[model samples]
Target: MPAALADGVVTRIPTSRKVVALTFDGGAGSQGAASILSTLRSQGVPASFFVTGEFATANPALVRQMAAVGPVGNHTWDHPHLTSLSDTAVRTELSRAESAVRAATGRTPRPFFRFPFGEYSTRTLALVHASGYGAVGWTTDSLGWKGTSGGQSVDSVVARVLAGRTPGQVVLMHVGANPDDGTTLDAAALPRVIAGYRAAGYGFTTLDALR
Candidate 1:
């Protein structure tokens, strides 16, 4: 992410296998939630969702389903930029998100967190760690949230994914849509992407497993 992490923010796993972790960010409502979940379930791929407190509270069914399958990570209370908040404010945000996920899924969120906007300061990192989570960063982002995840084109998303993929990498994709465009690229492209990875002899794993 920033060249190096003086604190313990993990961008990729330290391994040399063809194993990749696909993580989804669901900080808002359930826009493409069904498609993403169905594809992941039908394809038997594992993922970790970093859901905000607002998201979990708004979509309890989706949150429960996610928790039933794999790990969920805290994404803060309302997708606030943690760098702008005080240390107490940051802890409160994380705590609220953790509590929300726990309330929805009957399990505490995994001790992992993702900062809103991928913006974090040294103080933010220290605060998250103190709150009992290893900050989750990404090696390559799918950019699916920008415009249908990339540019209102499924092919573009796949192309970007194939071009940037590497062993032991953490791929970031989102499960919501842009309000203006109503585009969600990753779901439609997921099966093809999965097929592509399988064809190339790559295997899938969850971030929790990777860590």
Candidate 2:
């Protein structure tokens, strides 16, 4: 059954080797998306993006560009916390995102779904898989969501990412800006982060490559 396949919602892939997946979420403050994409492209690195429906619809051109270079996944309709919604609502959210992603990329997104705000429950998990997506979680959060506000600077964001990184770790970042001052550090910090990882001998891979 799909539930069995989606068991426990993958937080990190089980691997002993020195590999990590770099992933970004696209939602509200996606104006910095192009820069993030540019950094990824310039590095020739593979990554994954979990974008909301509004993000895909509002930025179709950016969506297509990301799809060409990295795999895309459903991040829900409007970045709602699934645990707050009924099972039916959860399904609706995921389906709407799927539809948007498909429209933008002309392909069904990878069957990877991430709960908005990293919030989920058993019922939400079952609903996610029932909607045909494997719920994805993170082992390492870039806290890039912190951006330059929330008392965290660009250097702090990079430090947070470097500190939590480990083999088989899945890092979480955002293509959006901070909700506070609308500061966007992800694009600026990504190139340095990538370079740091390479220096540390950590290889990058996409989520699809994880499984």
Candidate 3:
């Protein structure tokens, strides 16, 4: 793991195959979760989710459903910026999230984590590794979390995902809606995005490639 962590953070799946890893981050809310799950199941697509401790604790049923389909990674306890916390605090966040996931679904979120707001520093990276987790970033963000109010629509989300298409690409999306506009663009764009990818002759994958 240290040899892999030597690179600091992973933004793309470490492969040259024509497959992309779809990932969702959950923190503030679970507005789009059910729809996202339904779309993935209906399309037979696989995706990973990185959720906070608070989210798992609050939404145990959703966590179970997520764990049933794909791997769930830790996104920290409160989704705090790891770079802003001390070493012990950072560790506590990771451990707390891991515990919350286990408590909710009786499954472990070992060795996989993502920084809140994609924020981290060299020291924070080392701290994450030391806490027994790998930091997974993304090849591109769908930006659907920004919602229509932020000038993002379902079409833009699909476009951003297709624009980042490549071998082992990691697409980042959020399971929550925009706090301001309350739009779940990711869920709305998911079916179309999956169709577009299949039409482009690309396959879907989870972050398990890195494991």
TM-score for each of the candidates:
0.93, 0.94, 0.97
| Most accurate candidate by TM-score | 3
Using lDDT, give the best candidate's number. 3
Q: lDDT for each of the candidates?
A: 0.82, 0.83, 0.90
Model 2: ten consecutive residues of lowest lDDT? 1-10
Model 1 quality (TM-score) = 0.93
Off by over 4 Å in 2: 1-5
In model 3, the worst 10-residue window by lDDT is 1-10
TM-score of 2: 0.94
Local lDDT at 39 for model 1? 92
Tens-place lDDT per residue, model 3, 1-211, is: 6345346789988777889999999999999999999998888898999999999999999988898778899999998877878899998999999999999889888778999999999898888888788899999999999999999999999999999899999999999999999999999999999988899999988877787
What local lDDT does model 3 show for residue 156? 97
Which segments of model 1 are wrong by more than 4 Å? 1-6, 148-152
Q: Is candidate 1 or candidate 2 better by TM-score?
A: 2
